[model samples]
Target: MRGGEKCLEVFCEIFPEADLFTLLHVPGSVSPVIEGRRVVTSFLQRFPGVERRYRHLLPLMPAAVRLLGLGGYDFILSSSHCVAKAARGGPGAYHLCYCYTPMRYAWSAYEAYFGGDRLRGAARWVVPPVMKALRRWDAGTSAGVGEFIAISHTVAGRIRSCYGREAEVIYPPVDTDLYHPAGEPGDYYLLVSAFAPYKRVDLAAEAFTRLGRPLKVAGTGQDFERVRALGGPNVEFLGWQDDAALARLYAGCRAFVFPGEEDFGITPLEAQACGRPVIAYGAGGALETVVGLNPEEVTFPAGFQPPAGEEPTGLFFTRPDAEGLAQAVLRFEAEEAKFRPEAARRQALRFGRERFKEQARRRFVEGFERHQEKTAARRTGDR
Candidate 1:
């Protein structure tokens, strides 16, 4: 599962009895926790071959979301990265949307999802108008939601910019217990990610290839073939691995590479939980997660000196390119001894499942109370 599905699993644990509404669901694709719930899929689920080719059906998502009747539920919690946030609830129901982002494809990430190479032929012409319409609809639907909760400060900024609405930030959960270190570091570096255009997996593959170091990439997606072609003999593509295999890989790697700009990246935290230092692009959620040496703190004439009692867990490269990543790897090797495994593991513990659950409970209670107060005030004004 990706970050969004992992979030859905946590929601399932919180509201086991709540009905799940989604565009489509592939049976056995998600965790048992999510699958066990009474999943209420949209009209999109009835279409043949929708499971594998869902991206092709993006144009119809708004209509499909509207078709889902949420009137029966008194309280609605939508785990949304897309049209799920636009689901209409009953008139009296309180709706809270856990917004992953305000539709990346329809907004600033248009080129990443529908650029010249990504979308060809008639699609090139067709998609732009559809996305423009989707953007308008997305902004209009923001009023339907009573409150918004963002997964990260990064996403909260986007929500504010795109919809003109402020949102509370709640960092998502990571299962630290499942990713404990084995106390043995392996020779190879690691990258567990999907081969999407925006993920920048190709950059890591190219960097490792140029350096002639082993880089094990463990996940598959639409751009897998393109990413594989860019890699040399040093880069290994290990298509989607099971939890056992992923855990082993995490525990053994010298360092984890995260080249993508994510909403709230979970894989880096997972790697940190396994006591592995990370080499990440200095952007997005990585800015919040990774503790790196600051250039501003160093005096030029004094030269590089390790901070007393500070154990850095990762290194960051300002640019998201092969040369930048290659330099970062070389820098990490030079200061490799300063990064303690225990310190990385300690940092990962801060975003554990229990912390998320407690925070979520408090937010839900407070939001519900605010909703009631507003409703009571409206009634009094009418009198």
Candidate 2:
């Protein structure tokens, strides 16, 4: 399930009457309660190939969303990964979009998403109309929403750039307290990620193969076979793991290798909560999370060169290449003690679920009350 679904659950718990709306739904795929709620969709939800060609379908979303959202509801909280933020609002309703990023297709990762990499060429040829329409609608409906709740500072920047809107950053919640320290490191390295093209799981597999280190990959996606084909010696692919198994892996791994440049990676925080150090790419949210090895305070392992300007949380490799990632892992093994369990715990606390809930509740409630007052004033004036 997408992170948006989890956010929606929170929204539902807090506001039971709040209905769930989206572009599409795969029946029997999501919770019945969520599915049973008042249903609405963008017309693209009915398009034959819309799911397969989502990037192209994105442009259709604003029109489709507005079809359901226009002048409806008292409050709209969209757990958006796409143009759900474009949902229109009624007079008194507060549209609070929990934005993942300002739609990656039109912005920062546009080329990576549509630049003939894989389906980009076919999609480009096939869905020009939909893509164009979605872009226009995306821009138009963005003006409809009242407030935005960005999942991360990284995404907040994208939101501002793409929508010319200000957003409050509220990092997504992770159940860190439920995960425990295993107290022993397993011989294997761990990687858990949705197998999206941008995730770069190939890098982790390649690096593991090169280093001849034991690696266990957990998760499923279109790139599953491609990633498995690279597996050799010590690399193992274990389809999708449940929460228990995943938590155990986090607690057991020598280190968690997160190669992707995510908006805000929850897995890294999960691993840190488990008291394992992470080996992450230097850019994106990892820049804020992972700290690097220090030659002064700790021993530098051979074949590991520290990146310039790295802190002490975990090691950061600038390049996404297998060699660079492998070298960082090797170095982390050498200077593992420098990144203490307490330090890892401290980093996880920075994105604690309690903190996220507290911040979001305060911000949303304040915004909602302000909207409530404005609505009262408008009614009085009308009278």
Candidate 3:
């Protein structure tokens, strides 16, 4: 499961009977924890080839969400980075959103997703106005959410900026049991992410090309061809990997390469859980999760030491481009021996799946009970 699905899994365990509402639901596409639920899909699920063309159906998502039936439920919990936040609850119904971020498409990710070579022809011109309307709709609908929980401070900031709303930070979970350290790491560095524009997979391809080092990128999405075009023979793209294969990839990688500034990434922690250190861009959620050691020669002064006092789980490059990442990789190679597999695994343990489930259950229960009290008072006053 990806970050969102991982979070959803915790909720499924918390509330087994909660109806899953979405614009689309491909059977068996997600974990059994979710698939076993009473899943309700919107009108878009009926549209021909909608599953493949769903990202293109952005303009229709608001309407699609509106058609979703949640009449009987007084508490609607949304795991959203996009349209789910717009799912309106029935009168006095409490909508609790575990936000990944304000919708990236409707926020500052325009240049990455719609600009440059990512978007072309008439559609490039067409999508901006749609995004603008979505931004308004996104902000307008924030009123429905009784509370917002962000996966990280980075995402919490975006929620405030986008919707003029506040959010409590609740870091997501990683399945430490499933991702524990296994065999020895291999020669290649691993970069696992969907080829979304903001992910900067193209930069990873370019960085490995410059270093002439082995780097394998797992997962594919809208920017696949563009990223593949930037790579040399040194870089290999593995389309999509299952959980078992992915665990092996993480446990066997020399180090995980994370080039994106995420809301709060799960992959790096997953890699750490598998006893792999990460080489990442020093921003966003990476700062929170990674115990990043900066290079003495480059990042610090002649005598200056970068200190975590215990152990460093990863290395961070202040620069976000290919050259920055390539240099960080070199620094990582130089300081590689200092990083231990078990140490990294210990760091990953702090964000274990069970811990997140506990936190989620507590928050959801508290919010649901508080909402019930408020609803009772309102009904009593009406009488």
Candidate 4:
């Protein structure tokens, strides 16, 4: 499951009877914990082939999400990467949002999502103005949220920058119990992520191609064809695998490659939980999760070395491109023995599912109490 869905799973467990509101709903797309709930979809769900072509409706999403009309709910807990945070609550209702990021496509990831070659013809001319409007709408909707719980410090910073609001950071969970060390690692490297443009799967494929090392990618998305075309003989595509299959791949890979800069990447932690090291780009949540040699730490002439008693679980490439990643793979090969499986697994435990649940519960209680206090004060003033 994706990071947002994983968080939603916990929310569903905590509030089993709560109704789920969204812009669209594709049955069987998410876990039973979520799908089993009374999911209320907006007008966007009525659009023809909305499940597959939702990205084409990005410009209309703000209106569609706002149209969800969540005013009657006593408490609304929105798990938002995009417009879900914009859901309107009743005057007395508390809207607490667990924000993944401040709409990446509308903010920092604009080029990655709608850059040259991706957009075409009339669409290219239309998207810029639409994105500008989306950004304004995104910022405007932040006022409706009573409190914001960010998925990571990286995202908290973005929330502050984008919406002028502070948020508490709670790193997303990884199923360490399920993804624990199992079989011996295979010779190949693994990259498990959607083939989205921002995910930079193409960078990983090109890096492995240059290294002549086997790189197995698991998952598919909008950029699947583009990424698949870029892969050389050494790169293998294993489109969307089941949990068992994913766990097997995680346990068997020599090291996991995370080329993208995520708000908070759960996959890297999942790989670490499986006792496999990671080779990631030195940016975003990877900076916090991956305890390894960074580019800045790599001094010329003498090069970099881990201090005594220090245990690294992965390595980071300074650049987020093919050549940079290829160099990192070579570096990992050199000091591969230093990255102990036990150490990697230990690091993974720090962000366990139990930890997330506990933190989220505490935050929710605090937010609810604050909302109650505000409502009481307002009632007293009116009298």
Candidate 5:
């Protein structure tokens, strides 16, 4: 399961009685915990093989979301990156949205998703207007939600910018129980990521190629062939990995390399959970997660960069390029001994699975009660 599904698993444990809603759900494709729930898929689920071809059906998502039978539901919690937050609930329902991002394709990732100048035929013409409309609708739907919980402060900023709403940051959890420190660390640096355009796996491939250092990449996607082409003999692709295989890779690697500016990077935390250090681009979620080694080299916030005595858990590259990454790797190598594995383990523990469950449940219960109070007060005034 990906980070989103992993989060959903926690929700399933939290509210076992609540019905699951989604645009599509391929049975047995997710965790057993999620599968056991009473899943209510949208109209898109009626079409065969929609799971594989869902991204191609983005134009239909808004319509599909609206058609979902959300009536009579008193509490709705939408785990949303896209159209799920727009789910209109029954009257007096309190909807809390755990937003991963404010629709990246319509905003920050438009260029990456659309791939300007690479488009051909009708898609070149048809896709643009649909995204424009999506942006308007995406922003408009924020009013329906009673509260917003961001996966990271980085995402909280995006929520403020896109939806003009403030959000409380609740960082996503890492399964530290499954990913613990074990065995001797290996010589090669590691990266376990989807080979997508935004992931910038090519940047890692190119950096390792320049440094003539070993790098192991895991996972595959639409941009796999393109990223693979950029990698030299020094870089190796391990393809998709199961949980056991990924935990092994995390524990064994010298360091995990994160090339992209993610909204909230869960994989880096997973690496840290395994008592492994990370080398990441010094932006977005990395800023919040990584306790940087070379504070002067990277622009950290008021605390991390200034506090010279803190045991650094990772290194950060200011420039988002091959050369910058190569240099960060070199810096990590020079002072790698100073970074204690235990410190990384402790840092990862701060965002453990149980912590997330506690916070989410508390927020939902408290907010639901307040919403009921306001609803009752309004009805009294109406009378």
Candidate 6:
């Protein structure tokens, strides 16, 4: 019920289920968009101070999922970033989990979650034991799910590593059609991100200040004050923006600077759909989504910094550092023409909403049908 809420917003639209199951909810805490829908929380409902230390509530998750009757549903889809993937399903039921990443707090960013950062430090002092207990619960509960749909190949790799389970990569959806190319380039580079430690917006601010390029950042989070404090003359931080405003920014921007090494960056695709070229860390969905221009032909590399002349659909920083990002931004402006509106549009087409829906439908139906066939064969043999 945090950043994973964004992915849940997309999945709920696609599948359109009747009842939504979750661990907890703070009314009006999440966006009003999900109101009126029946959200069934786990047994930890109204537990004293649970919302504040909710990550600690992980131990209760298995018990909560077990409380959900798998036998009662025709299809059980879990929009998970964590153990929501671990929800059990009966033999005939189909459990489709849209995984964000295999538990960031445990696998990848363990130190960061418990590191000397203010929040982590506070968590350590207050809820270290609970966090430890939940991690153990999370590992055990992961074995319950029937199938996993990863949001990115990076996440699919994590799924393999943590659960010893394979997952199909389904790039998260963006409203491409809604974010058409503005056709008029603005004077500034743009950033649309929540101020999280992992996002590394500090690098962007530093680079823009050094290079003397105007940068406008949109979105807000816990790190907002720190991020703003780091900003120099050329950087402007706009707290948060609506879709219309964000689309306008995407449309008119010279380029979209995405500093984070995201699992799958919806923002970059959104920028490309608006015919603005992306400057992203070369990793995760950027590998599959953005085509690097090389002289020989267009090729998609697995991580950042593709071979030159690859159509410049987007420029990738060699790594996630200020200097690398600055150089990439400079290179993007120098070779910006190669990233034509038509080419950006063409690349964005691969991640269109319709394509994603069709793929999901095919996979879900195919998997469910196969399960049915296997069940039928087993029953017939027994008879």
Highest lDDT scorer: 5
Instruction: Return the TM-score for each candidate structure.
Output: 0.94, 0.85, 0.93, 0.95, 0.96, 0.84
Write candidate 2's Cα lDDT for 1-383 as tens digits: 44556556556656667666777876666656577677666667777876567654554565676687467577777777776786766766787788887666665665555556555456667655555555666666778778888877677776777778878777776677766587787889999998876788999999899889899999998788988898787899998887789989899988889998887778888898888888888766665555555334333322233445533667777766888888888788888777777677767777776777677778888988998898889899999
By TM-score rank, best first, the candidates go 5, 4, 1, 3, 2, 6
> All candidates: CA RMSD in angstroms?
4.1, 5.5, 3.8, 3.7, 1.9, 4.0
Query: Which residue ranges in model 3 land beyond 4 Å of their true spot?
Result: 295-308, 378-383
Q: For candidate 3, what is the total of clashing residue pairs?
A: 0
Residue-level lDDT of model 4, residues 316-363, one tens digit each, is 887778999999899999989889999999989989999999999988
Give one digit per residue, the lDDT tens place, for model 1 in 1-383. 77788877877777777788888889999998888888888888989999879988988999999989988876888889888899887887898999888988898567777876877789888888999999999999999999999988778888888999989888888889898899689899999998888889989988999999999999999989989999999899999998778989999999999988888789999999999999988777776677776544322211113334556889888877999999999988899998888999988898898898888888887888999889999999999
- Clash count, predicted structure 1: 0
Q: Rank the candidates by lDDT, best first.
A: 5, 4, 3, 1, 2, 6
- Candidate that scores best on TM-score: 5
Note the residue pairs that clash in candidate 2. 42-64, 59-134, 291-313, 291-314, 292-311
| C-alpha local distance difference test of each model | 0.86, 0.74, 0.86, 0.87, 0.88, 0.74
Model 6 spans with C-alpha error above 4 angstroms: 1-17, 26-36, 43-71, 90-93, 116-136, 294-310
lDDT for each residue of candidate 6 in 1-383, tens digit (9 for 90 to 100): 24356556655566665677777777776655565578777778778888667756665666776776566676777777666766766666666677887766666666545566545445556556766666677667666666788887777877777777888777766677778887688889999998877787888988898899999999987678988988887899988888889889999999888887677778888888898888887766566667655323323422234334445577666556899888888788788777887778777877777777777778777877876787789899999
Q: Which regions of candidate 5 fall more than 4 Å away from where they truly are?
A: 296-309
**Model 4 per-residue lDDT at 129:** 93
Candidate 4: global Cα-lDDT? 0.87
lDDT for model 6, please.
Answer: 0.74
Mark the 10 consecutive residues where model 6 has the least summed lDDT.
295-304
